[model samples]
Target chain A: MNRIAQGLTLVLLGAAALTSTVPTDLYLNWVKPGFGPFLIAAGVVMVLLGVLVIVAELRGGDQALDQEDVVPSGAAAAGDDGPARSELDHAAAEYAGHTGDGHGHDHERAPGVAWLLLLPVLAVFVVAPPALGSYTVESTGGSSGPPPRDENGSSRFTDNLSEAAPGEVVELDVQQFVMRAWVDEERELADREVELTGFAVPTEDGEGWYLARLQMACCAADAVVNKVLITDHPAPEADTWWKVRGTWVEPEGELYDASEHEIDTSSVEAVTDPPDPYE
Target chain B: MSERTTPERGSAPDPATSLGDTIAGGWDDRGDELPPADWGRSSSSRRTGTVWLFALFITAMAVAHAWLTDDLTGQAFLAWATIFTAISFQALPFLVFGVALSAALVAFVPTSAYQRFIPSRPGRAVPVAGVSGALLPGCECASVPIAGSLIKRGVAPAAALTFLLAAPSINPIVMIATAVAFAGQPEMILARFAASLLASVVIGWVWVRFGRADWLRLPSRTHAPNASKWEVFRESMVHDMMHAGGYLVVGALAAATLNVMVPREWLMAVAEAPVISVLVLALLAILLSICSEADAFVAVSLTDFSPTAKLAFMVIGPIVDLKLIAMQAGVFGWRFVARFVPICLVVGLLSTFLIGGILL
Candidate 1:
């Protein structure tokens, strides 16, 4: 791969990382807000280095290319093809910094596998894709039951759900509502009006949508769907972010059954997805 | 070949005094013209028609940007991309941390420092390297490139390999995290430590005895060029970042694809058979590739599975995964990963099972 190409790709990748992480949108899709600053710093460093590589090469510092360290010996193996070996040997010989054949850095070979590195850069900057949506919800069987324990493996409802006077409006997350419903023996939410916010995920039965939030443990890869059903109401548009004023209606089914701990919405409003969409 | 250096291939040159001249006439037979002095000032520094290649990539990216910005984002693409970027974002800092360390060593420290501490014999170095894993606190991303850099500086490959596996799995931070996550069951912490140590050492010994020289494409000892120390540090850092970052993405993509493709329901389908449970948990370890420090929490929460199965998940998550596979392939090359990952999986499974069964 050409050293200049390597440098430019670095610059682009770094730039994309900087822009994507600094904004609030990244929180919507993958991870928490913890890694934003680090990514920005890494992006700055990468761009600086990319610029340096180009400058060094431009100043007739072809020796800087030797820093590329095209050690062809690594390409050798017990049973490799002759052409692959020769191509590697040729590439190695071409960039033999100090103790091999005497040709300076050559760009003629093209960026071989190094070109693969550019794919992420393209995906990041070009595609600039968004977060998990209905397709993921459908594929992964959506938020199922309450976790085996309060995510910590304890038997009791771990969240602090204190007594709210009758008709008092209390705000809670979709997860907290479910946890209390699953394990709280005190029936603290029996008569309290609780408001919760999440995006609308369509029910498999097509009767209504579940107000759901995805809980990411580390990053998007391990996100767990935590959803509460919305009943006695028409389903809003799929994946529509919602803030609903409602109270918990006792489910006709067992605990954590889609119907069991659902919210009976007195009022519902459709809103845009939040900056940090996942819970 | 010099007495200290291992003989590689036949290409040799007359007494080369400077790195510059060696690169200039190095491949005298490979007739590629040097771009003019003013070529440096050009917008596209690429020469000999490579500009078109760069231009094509940029053009394709531009078109993608246009199509993506029109509010036509698909959930599938968005989900895939989000997962992809998240993996990259997560790995970015650790990879940079590793590159910074290796770069410092390459730029600042004399090779003699490594030689003095690390044993020369492959057999003797394995345990020392494996035990030293307890000291490095970072995850797998940090260890892979460092191991590659060490091999470049003449540390035995066996030792480097041993440290690569052990550092991420058995480090103090990971052990402490495991202890905290499994508060009631102290056995998990000890089991993870023992199993990881056993696996790493076993792999090291196996490599010492059976690993083919060609299996690993050992890194070249790239010395800092004649520049300021800052320049040397920057150069080493940049170079390692480029190589390692590229492979890390490949690993990330494989993991993201698997994350979506394999229905998450499989996690709930735990068979009662001990062997099946072990295999399922082991497979989950490969797919999830959770950070070593936090995997204990994930494992302990899975009360439906046997403790032994959860133990297998704890031990195997850090050792083998699609991400680790891609990274190992990235640093050590696919040749090494081809044999190495399979060997690791088998040995890691047995180690976890044997140790976890006895302890848990």
Candidate 2:
């Protein structure tokens, strides 16, 4: 029973890992894209291990059983004939020693606690939870903007912000928009019309919604929210994706002092979710 | 099954045999034969039961999911599930790599090799092991089983335990990730290395002074010398994966729940105070249970907290977190974890503050 449970658990986990990464891009919602090959390799290894276990059990069962009946009694009677005994007899003796002490090490079996592995197998294969959306952003209290500047008072994004020709709308992701809005000392985004895409999050006051996106370092578990308040535009339904053209509205504070960044929207259009939901 | 039971029944009536002798002799004779026959017989019966239970579980989940889909759309419960699945999925490959390496050590490496390499004295060996942690480049999940296997191979408990605490934090991959996360602040990377090394060594020394052998249930060595190395490797790898993966699931559940349920405002409220912020971030590290490689990015996001408090978060996270605590209790006994976790936590905090004060 324990052997079957162990083998089944391995196979199930392997299958779950494979299905998550192989056929679809479901794993992207959970981890970074670079993890694809590693997860697939791990899955193959697990499945091979599980199959090897079952095969070994089937092939060796009867022969080992026949050997067991003769070896133990023979070894016990001729206890002093240690050097004369075969290697199989020596292994049987070690197995006896393990079982003699109450700490019997079942070489082929797993602990009962291992049955809990079914939980993740069920979760991944059955529930199939979606990616983090507007709920996470609101719950985590929205974006804290970008990291502070270095001691030299320079920002990485400063040089990347090129001067745009007048009336040309620049395209930026929600992350870059929030970063420049907070740390860019030149106020480069203030006069330039820019385009950003994110899922909508309705504001509490019912005036205008926040355009929000989650940025993760490794996986969804460490994801943080980056959002911009879209003022003067009507609120869209929560979590619906949209592309908005807007000009940055300079807030009343020094850089990194303001809790929120606002953008005055010129136009709003409903759009499908992006291929990569996170930045 | 019937044929196997006949011998057992015949052997049971020996009046000359004492119960202990009968048990030991019977187990010795039947160990190879009975387990296989029993496994074959029980598996067929149990497989059906398992299949039925699984179908019922799926059906129930389908019903619940259908009912809850509308209400749970963009809700906290869905958020919790996403985080839980993400953590488990992200950690799974690293855990597999760790168990595979651990199994190789048990099967391929000779026990004598450990004694010949490590110093005899616990004091000298502890720092040696701590410094050697930089060799392993994987995250925290990989180190726990490797540490457990190191102890199994006769390395000193203090030295192996020190390796566990230090490997995840000071490794090259984690350091690079930290450097990228705190891009311009080279001091943060140096401080992390110094603080993690100091804390790991200090905790190892403390263990050498105060720890008891009986508190830790040393991992049992498996497979006799006569067994093939491939057989030993396969057996140990499967066993360790089953054992550790279950605990990983437990850790993921706790972290996910805390991630969704704990309000960000509470952490923000304490971010301004110097001493309280450090303590708060330390506690937050335990609760968040973020992987050490990714934790720097999360630390950078906490713009409200001081560099010292962020240092505490980074230091305490890799060494002592909900996931590590669960894995430790699974590998070592609960008694060992109860003592070991607190010691690591306190040492990690003190080392962080000391290093952060000096550098930042």
Candidate 3:
């Protein structure tokens, strides 16, 4: 891309980054909610820097597109109908000299793949995807049965907080619930009718479906899918929100099969998608 | 796109036509009255092209929104998009910081500053750079360009590589995160720090010893003398962003794809045997391409693994990974990465094993 195009892109990038984090939690779909303000500031700086470059280019301050690209393309310098200008338009095509096809813009120095950077920009600015679901989990093979953390490690949980008091149907995080059900030898959750929340997802094995919650340990990149198989109920329409009252059942299938962890359904209720989809 | 129709730009005497002028002075003009064509190069075409592309991209997004609103393919695409955008968003601040710092070094920082602090010898420079990395709090994504700038600035390549390897792995933010992730086991943090530092210095010396200058592809350090310092600074920042941002996308794509595609079961399966588990976790670290500051949480989550294996995971991750590989390929060419990655991996794994064996 030309310096002008690069500057405009930076300006757009800054605007996108800043807006994604502000006035709403829209950015939460892509990043941690806590990271919003820093992103806003970065966006602002990028915008300013972009403006600086644009003003410089407008004054013809920049002499060359870049000091040195791997392969300096069509250095036409707009000189007397330099035919090479057409060849230079493939900004990113020069990288590794991969494909010489006329795919890039007509800028001599702009990185050709520079256009691909807009893919994410368009994605965030437009239809922000929801948190990851079971499909990602199944595809990544992250459904590695329940972790063996039998000992509850939530520093948030205190001694007096014991199991669901009587039959109150205590609500639990799907992650905590799964961990407790699988290894809580005390059978703390065995007889308790616990409330759980998540969107419905199709099971990978095709035998059943799961009520799954996607958790982001860090960012969306590190999203972990925590699932509880709903044995008695067919999966609700994909990604439908539900609040279920269920009892933990003995796992079935191979010892290591993640699908073995099932929830015996007592009741299932429809709910709107929660603001925070992760545990 | 606007350039296509600009007849004025085509009519101007192309300074670049003469190979001598293109080589000596790319855009520098000796004439008193500037060519109107110079203005054409920066004219309405650029703005119009940007606006046109902007409208096209938005229309495409609208179509995508409709498709995503109703289809599963849209959902899958969104999943991929979120991961992709999250990476660029996260890297922006670091990119800003790095470019500003590199630009400041070029503009304000004097040659005396390097003479005063940095040693010329590779043996001493490697340690100095490795230790100085404690100062930078940015991620590996930020380091590639900064390292590139450092090399362009005349710092020894080995020293810059040391800084590159050390900054993301041992910086305070990363160390603290490692501590938090491995809380109650302070020793894991120590092991990671020592191992990562050791790995870095080892690799640096290896570069000093065996690295061929021709094999490393670097941007020329030449500067346009006529450009103002502010102009230079802005150029530095924009140039680095454009070059690094593209590869960051590539790296992020690999990270996101590998993250979902690599079965966690396989990682967990090999957790029983210590030797195999160390290799497995180290390989997983390369695949995960997670930020070093945040990887501790991931390591901690793998509860069944031995602490040594976790150390291997943390040490290897920042120094070498799919993301780092992509960035390296972008900045230094594939040849450099071909030789550099295997060497770093072997060194990173070996150091982690030795240190973890003793410390854990």
Candidate 1 chain A: 10-residue stretch with minimal lDDT: A100-109
The per-model lDDT (C-alpha) reads: 0.67, 0.76, 0.68
DockQ per candidate, 2 decimals: 0.23, 0.25, 0.22
* lDDT of model 1, residue B87: 79
Q: Write the per-residue lDDT of candidate 1 for residues B1-360, one digit (tens) a residue.
A: 111121111123222212122223222211222334344633224332344455556666666666755565677667777788777777777887888887787567766787899888989999999999999888888888788767766677889889999999999988987876666566777888999999999999998999866677533322333456677677657666766777777777877777767875666676467889988988888887776766776676565688788888877888898778877765566677899988888889889888987897
Quote model 2's TM-score: 0.85
How many clashes does each candidate structure show, in the order listed? Answer: 10, 0, 6
Error of 1 at A168 (Å): 5.1
lDDT of 1 by residue, A142-251 (tens): 43533444333333444444644556688787777877776555557766778888888888889777887776656777676667878778888788888988877765
Chain B TM, every candidate: 0.80, 0.84, 0.83
Tens-place lDDT per residue, model 2, B1-360, is: 434443443334222222233233323323323343345444334533553444454456456546654555547777888899889888999999999999898779987788898997989999999999987898889899898788777778889999999999899999999998888899999999999999999999999999877677643543555779899888878878877787888899999999999998998888999999999999999998999999999998888899999999999999999988988876775778899999998899999989999999
Q: Which segments of model 3 are wrong by more than 4 Å?
A: A62-108, A125-127, A140-170, A182-194, A202-209, A230-235, A245-267, B1-76, B265-274, B303-306
Worst 10 residues of 1 chain B by lDDT: B1-10
Q: Which pairs clash in model 1? A: A74-B217, A101-B26, A102-B25, A102-B26, A102-B27, A103-B25, A103-B26, A103-B27, A104-B23, A251-A260
Tens-digit per-residue lDDT, A1-279, candidate 3: 666567656766765676566554667776677777778777777767765655555444344443223233554222222233222112112222322222122223456666666655665646565667656766655453335432344442322226447877778788767666555555566677778898887766777778877766567776666788887987678888899888887554433343446788999999987866666
Docking class for model 3 is incorrect
Displacement of residue A62 (Cα, Å) in model 1 is: 3.6
Model 2 pairs whose backbones collide: none
Q: Write the per-residue lDDT of candidate 3 for residues B1-360, one digit (tens) a residue.
A: 222322233234232122222212112221111333544544344444554565555556556656754564565676776677776677667767776777677666655566568798877899999998888898887888777766655577788889999999999999998876565677888898899999999999999999866566654323444556776677767766776777777878888777655667777788999899999889888987887767877787776788888888899999998878887766676778899999999999999889988999
Q: Once superposed on the true structure, which residue ranges of model 2 sit more than 4 Å away at CA?
A: A61-106, A149-155, A158-160, A163-168, B1-74
